[model samples]
Target: MIDSGSTATRRISRTSLVVALALCLALAGCGDSVAPPSLPIGSHRAATHVVAPGETIYHIATEYGVSVGRLMAANGISDPRDLRVGQVLTIPGGDRGASIGTASSGVRRYTGARSSRQFQWPVQNGVVSSGFGIRNGAMHDGVDIAAPAGTPVYAADSGVVIFSGTLHGYGNTVIIRHDDDYATVYGHNERNLVSEGTRVARGQEISEIGRSGRTTGANLHFEVRRDNVAENPLAYLPDPASSDRISFAAAGGS
Candidate 1:
């Protein structure tokens, strides 16, 4: 888990990739006060869900805030390939689905599921304004992608939108809980296009660029958290493109 005393240091990285971070009170910095709307990830009991076309165990488990292993165990699903559209499976936990928010206090445990899917750039065009590490007197847990205000922000991978609302200092934010304890944060958004509990495809438009909270300018505060611990987003993002790709510039430089 991310401690309040996490260290900070400036670091620049290579270019031509698409990893991410955020400047929200939930992950990085905290200031200001915005009353966010209540998330609608209503209770999810030990219910049964019928499979839909193009659905997989990953997306299904994410939607119910449960892990694929748990779901498979509950329903005795041996091979994931055995699942077919119109098939029914039992959800493990009985009628209690908390909105998947930051891996903060009172967070639920979700283990045993991993995504093999690849990640892509969330923004069409941007510059690496900041890299992850210690910054000022606090830990800059995520990177900042500099872009024009209103630039479309897409999902890094397919997963469930566990939290989509404003938080103190984050102006507006959307947090998606991907497979295998992988969660991505898109903060300081001009607007959030998706809602909590909504499943999004890889590269799907989720928000827009904005200088909502404590930021130097219009940028997307992106973060990829592993089991609540801050990680270097650039490490997982694919190599940046030739011209209009997300460039790391260099490591230990941003």
Candidate 2:
């Protein structure tokens, strides 16, 4: 027979071991529930994140516990769709944080080199249903080109597709970063034919028009940005009255 005192001691040891294991499991669960840590101001230099496949700007911002607008502004990205796989993004930290405003309030400024690139009309057989500038007490950052559903939308100029995805208010959008400080936006697409990082030439079909996002009917919402500032696309586009086809003599054409 076992010694009675020794048996009691062994029972107590087993009970203690079970309690210890339970405490460890509880601690591990708590750790998993803790929120992601924010980068402390001045704790370290800004970190860089390499874009991985299937990663979007929104996901990265969430992972870093930063606002999407701040992350975009820090990188001079005016359109959310401009994020691409394999791109290196600078994570804003310390006093390097940037403030970005809504479309109605305007956005952070970016001073890129002067661009002479001309833009071609993105939608064929479309009419300007709405122009850019203040409308209904808010800023209309881009023009609405009304077209029938399924109308092909072309790239305004040659550029690499920086972003192509769905965005709030803009719906399915495609943003192209051209030479110099210029970029173009095409929004309200029913479908996007090109993916991010693809090189597109002027007049190449990138999307099909649709009544996506905040729209009353089928149309393509288009904008031209220089140095990340929205400009009146009409000023850059060939006058519709001049020609139905591409105009080589548009004011800003080379």
Candidate 3:
């Protein structure tokens, strides 16, 4: 019982409704094929999101393109593993999960002090198989510490995890950045315990020694980088001591 003009108007309203819903979904990062937005460079608004089942801090930080440490800091989250299914977290991006927003913004800034700790030997027990510098007519960027296949790898120093993933032949790698602007890289790990951007302590377990990338046996490929240049790790590691038990484990693993 409607004219053609009225029917067209009704159709337009329906289309508008659908479009609005789609935009909302896009903002929430749900049901859309679009890649999650990266954090914008300019001013932005704050948004709140309830943690969903099976969501991890790493996943949320990557989705928003913000550092996991920053995200955790924003919400005052002390423990990343303690996230609840319905827990509310403050997403530190633009409003509605949008990466960018206009000049008018409403977001609170989180100001907290970082942890102050030094570095320690990453692997609990291992024998030095390879040292830094040129080897076999090629550059050896790191030291290879031979360990058991599943020996836990500790943090050489306290720092924030800048990376936790694969890197070509490095295998399951983890790179931690220390307060002194030095970074340590742990490669050929069986498993990475900490996610990128999470603050870690000295002597904390970060991964497990493994031959994940291009190693012939179980070992940890350790590297120390300062301002992005490779350096010698032995210069920093503690001198071999009886407490290390490196000799005991080396005998069995070797």
Candidate that scores best on TM-score: 1
Q: Rate the local accuracy (lDDT) of all candidates.
A: 0.58, 0.57, 0.56
Q: Write the per-residue lDDT of candidate 2 for residues 1-254, one digit (tens) a residue.
A: 11234646635533442332233223211000111123422233466888898887656665554444446767887565678888989876522333222223321111222224457889778666554433222234456776788999999989877678876566687887776556788878999999976888889999999877657778787877654544556556655554573222101100
Assess the local accuracy of residue 223 in candidate 3 as a C-alpha lDDT between 0 and 100.
69
Candidate 1 vs 3: which has more lDDT = 1
lDDT of candidate model 1 versus the reference: 0.58
> What ranking emerges by TM-score with the best candidate at the front?
1, 2, 3
How does model 2 score by TM-score? Answer: 0.52
Q: How well is each residue in 35-64 modelled by candidate 3, as lDDT tens digits?
A: 112343222456677889999865665455
Q: Model 1 over residues 19-58: C-alpha lDDT tens digits?
A: 2222224432422111000121122357788899998765
Poorly placed runs, candidate 2 (over 4 Å): 1-116, 241-254
Per-prediction TM-score to the true structure, in the order listed: 0.54, 0.52, 0.51
- For model 1, state the Cα shift of residue 91 in Å: 38
